[model samples]
Target: MNYTLRTALQGLWHDKWLNLLCTLTIATSLFLVSLASVAYINIKTISAKLPDRFSITVFLNEDLEEERIKAIISQVQKHKSVKKLKYISREQGLADLRLSLGDADYVLEGIEGNPLPPSLEIGVTRRAVSGDGVGRLVRD
Candidate 1:
């Protein structure tokens, strides 16, 4: 084993530049790929384990009045498993979109006005995010 190690080291030193370059390149690529994979797994685990982080957004008819939106939210809030609800007004939604767009002037320029209306953003309690529970809320 010592002889073999000595011979391998001598051969590596013969092409030091090429060996070093290949070793560093492989190491860097492996590090980046491993890091990305770890980050992806962490993100997936986070999303899967915490279902309550997602909001169940129900969009009503565009012509629907704000009063109906409020009433729907009130009904949803009555549910024992509902954590919170948000009614996003059209203007507020538009502002959110603009903020997300980062001043991309042409992003919504073609759109004349805010088409999105006040919708119910319902946050389910931790235990109420099962498939059946979500289905019940959707059916309501």
Candidate 2:
């Protein structure tokens, strides 16, 4: 058995290039498989988190009256799928935009009045994370 092992080692030493190629091939395959597995896990994690971040923002017409805006908010709040509802006035929207823009708020200096319209931000509940549930809520 020892003689056979010595012969095998001698053969490998004589064909060093072939042994190196085989070793490199095995290493490369393992590296690629590991990389693919990591990517698959990351994708699954991101997709699972997508539902929690799902939301619906309804942009109301600028001419909509205060009463109509309140009515819309009330209606949206009554929906079973709605986990939370928030009303963003034109002023609030402008403020938020300014904050987001940081120093770029100067770009809006030439604009006359807040052109931004009021909007309703609705958060969907965990139970309503399904595609159909979100679609039904939007349709209704």
Candidate 3:
């Protein structure tokens, strides 16, 4: 007999089928949206990882002193937008080349005295790997 807010809500609660339908519809919508959000985030993370795949070869002068190389590397590290720098010694490069050219005797023979240069593979942060940023880094 009481027509209070509680009593009115109790009437809606009696419509079990209708309430269940609404609940399922809302849950389904939420699940779809959440899945889309996760996919979008995955795409973004993969994009960031892609930058690590991009590399810049910093060729060292054949006779560059170790001190000079270290000094340049320090400056490169200080760059605000650099994410990571990986150094590859000449021996490592030669080894990698040999591994890649397995069974190619001609390719192996043609390379002499570790012609490959010691270099750093630079991976720029998401904000700095663009064409313009690469040019600026090379220029500076």
Candidate 4:
């Protein structure tokens, strides 16, 4: 074993530059593989969280009666994937827009009236964000 070790060491010493190059190549490959794995994991995590951010906004006609709006709300609620529902009145939407605009709210002041429409903001389950679930919801 000692003789084998001595021979191996001699061979490595004789080809020191080649050994170093091989070592560096192997290390670089491993590092790249590790980086790719980390990137893939991070992408998967972000994609999973994407469903939580999914939402649908349904704008109602300005002249729709309260009863029709209620019916629309009921219909949306009947979907199994519906997780949360919020109704935003025209005034509330304008307020929210102003809040979001901050100092830029001056841009909205030129408008004579609230141009935003009343709408329903609907949050859905993760399953609803994938495949044909969203399509079905929109169709209904």
Q: Native-vs-model 2 lDDT?
A: 0.91
Model 4, CA-based lDDT: 0.93
Task: Residues 1-140, candidate 4: write the lDDT tens digits.
Answer: 99999999999999999999999999999999999999999999998889999998989999999999999899999989899999999999999999999999899877998898899999999889966988888887
Off by over 4 Å in 2: 63-65, 126-132
Candidate 1 per-residue lDDT over residues 1-140, each given as its tens digit:
99999999999989999999999999999999999999999999998878858678777677877677677778888988789988887788778878888859577888887777666678988777788888877777
- Residue runs of model 3 more than 4 Å from their true location after superposition: 1-49
- Stretches off by above 4 angstroms in model 4 are 1-7
**TM-scores of the models, in the order given:** 0.61, 0.85, 0.60, 0.83
Backbone clash count for every predicted candidate, in the order shown? 0, 0, 0, 0
Model 3 per-residue lDDT tens digits across residues 1-140: 56798887887889878989999999999999999999999999998688767768788877988998889899998987778988788899888878887888467675458788888888887667799988888877
Candidate structures ordered by TM-score, highest first: 2, 4, 1, 3
What lDDT is reached at residue 108 by model 4? Answer: 86
Best-performing candidate as measured by TM-score = 2
* TM-score head-to-head 1 vs 2, winner: 2
lDDT of candidate 3 at residue 80, scale 0 to 100? 77
Which pairs clash (backbone N, Cα, C closer than 3 Å) in model 2?
none
> Per-residue lDDT tens digits of candidate 2, residues 10-120?
999999999999999999999999999999999999988887888888899999988988888888888999988989989999999999999888899999988999888
**Candidate 3 structure, TM-score to reference:** 0.60
Every candidate's lDDT: 0.83, 0.91, 0.84, 0.93
